[model samples]
Target: MLTLAAGASAPSVATQLVGSGLIGLREGLETGIVVMILVAFLVKSDRRDALKWVWLGVAAAVAMVAIIFVAIHFGTSTVTGLAAELISGLASLVAVVIVTAMILWMRKAAASISGHLRAGLSKALAVGPFAVASMAFFAVGREGVETALLLVGYAENTAGSIWPLVGLLLGIAVAAALTVALYFGAVRINFAAFFRYTGVFLVVVAAGILAYGVRALQIAGWLPGGSNLAFDVSAHFDTSTWYGTVLQGIFNFRPDPTVLQVVAWAVYLVVVLTLFLRPLPAKPGPERAPLPEPSNIPAS
Candidate 1:
């Protein structure tokens, strides 16, 4: 949607499906893993009753996100021009910040996250099902909200909401099916590889969004020097041309980019990618030697 909104052509259904499928696959796998971990923990502790709480939390989170989406949608309808631009720009910036934080958190604490979750769940279960549900709600809610915000931005920009939304729904449905399969040990995929690649893709996508947001601000006349055309490729390739349209849809590519937009895009890609690809810090060595039983927590 971000791509389309930035003057890119509308994508075919196949392309939307593919893109949404990838997103769904990644997100679904993460959620699946979390649920699996909870189930496993419950089984180990003989606390099957707590599973209900997890479901409650998931439902609550979904509802909360839905409410937010509706509010933003209706609110945007009443606002025009600069107000709409500011809203979208601010939302994009918030998404960028949240995504950045999430990436950093994953990098710094991936190894210990499972352990922390297990500890929290153990405590929550003792407090009853409500506590369990709250934990689950928050666990899933964070991912859900982020996905919703990003999708909304995409929808607004591309004017291709119907297809993308359909694609997103389909992707999620497939993911849910796969989750069930995973529970039965009927499917397996290297999650580490999946996250690594998707993380890189998301970084690029987010950078494009950041650039798009800046352009929006420029359009609203909030940002300076937007009137000056940095360069023009309209002579060689019109925006309506097949190649131009495709480039626009895929990467939010503009033949004529402003100085600020170009600089923002370049700097974002270089800085974010460099930081994202850097080697993570090593975990500290254990103080004690071997234990009688092995730990369930996996090493990063």
Candidate 2:
């Protein structure tokens, strides 16, 4: 086990399991929903011939994401010491930015996404098989790339433990089952509420990651104030304990955080939370089509 400064223990294998699971669930569902939409559209519009192409695109996207994930997760293993720390810090920061944009964009786009997707698919059909496949590839690929990057960031926090990967796979499995259920009209969900709640959870997670990133940079000597203590509750709160593991795993909480970490965490949480929770500008309800959109999936 790698010894951290000031009596802070290295994270255990299970430390980040829950956080990774949630990320997988959210990202997997988004990817699944895109596939469901495209498939349903093709089926309903009598474009069954294009179904194979759509599947091809989805398969390609998944394969691409897997390759990217493997390359990234293992690539950093080659580096040691400060270089690794610097990479981890930068990667975590990038994940935070991407996840933040995803959260905010989903808030606005969720309402209109179905119509836009259908429209895009329609145009792609006119273009030919390659376009149709490319459309699905890009649509799902975006979510896949985001998921890969986020998972890597989470894994870095846990010192490359296998538990984070296990948690993510479990979450994706659940998401897949849920997506299948919804696709077959066996379940109904208020997607708006779902996204909103998950978005909030992710924002908190991202804030934690951002703080972790700042600490990493500081450790790597890329930033000053590594020893500038904001507060050290190491005596009172042991990170190796069960509760401590949970806190560190879920929120990246450190008993001895630097001034910069605390400031980054606080500012990000307050600003992003406020923006996320604020009422959105009024707009017409999303357009409807013959096939039910994700928001309108039927239960029973």
Listed per candidate, the RMSD to the true structure in angstroms reads 4.7, 4.2
TM per candidate: 0.84, 0.90
Per residue, candidate 2 scores C-alpha lDDT tens digits across 11-70 of 554556577888889988878888888887887788899999998999899999999888
lDDT, candidate 1, equals 0.66
87, model 1: CA deviation in Å? Answer: 1.9
Candidate 1 — worst ten consecutive residues by lDDT sum? 286-295
Residue 46 displacement in candidate 2 (angstroms): 1.0
Estimate, for each residue in 1-300, the C-alpha lDDT of model 1 and write its tens digit: 322334333444455556556666666556666766676677677777777778788889879977876676666556787888878777767767777667655545545556767788988877888889989889877777766665555445555345556666787788788777766667765554566788787677677677777787888777886877678886786656556544554356677778888888889889888887787665565412111011243321
lDDT, residue 218, model 2 = 97
Q: How many clashes in candidate 1? A: 2
Mind sharing the TM-score for model 2? 0.90
Task: Name model 1 segments beyond 4 Å from true.
Answer: 1-11, 238-246, 284-300
Clashing pairs in model 1?
Answer: 5-157, 53-133
Candidate 2, poorest ten consecutive residues by summed lDDT: 1-10
**Which residue pairs overlap in candidate 2's backbone?**
none
lDDT of each: 0.66, 0.81
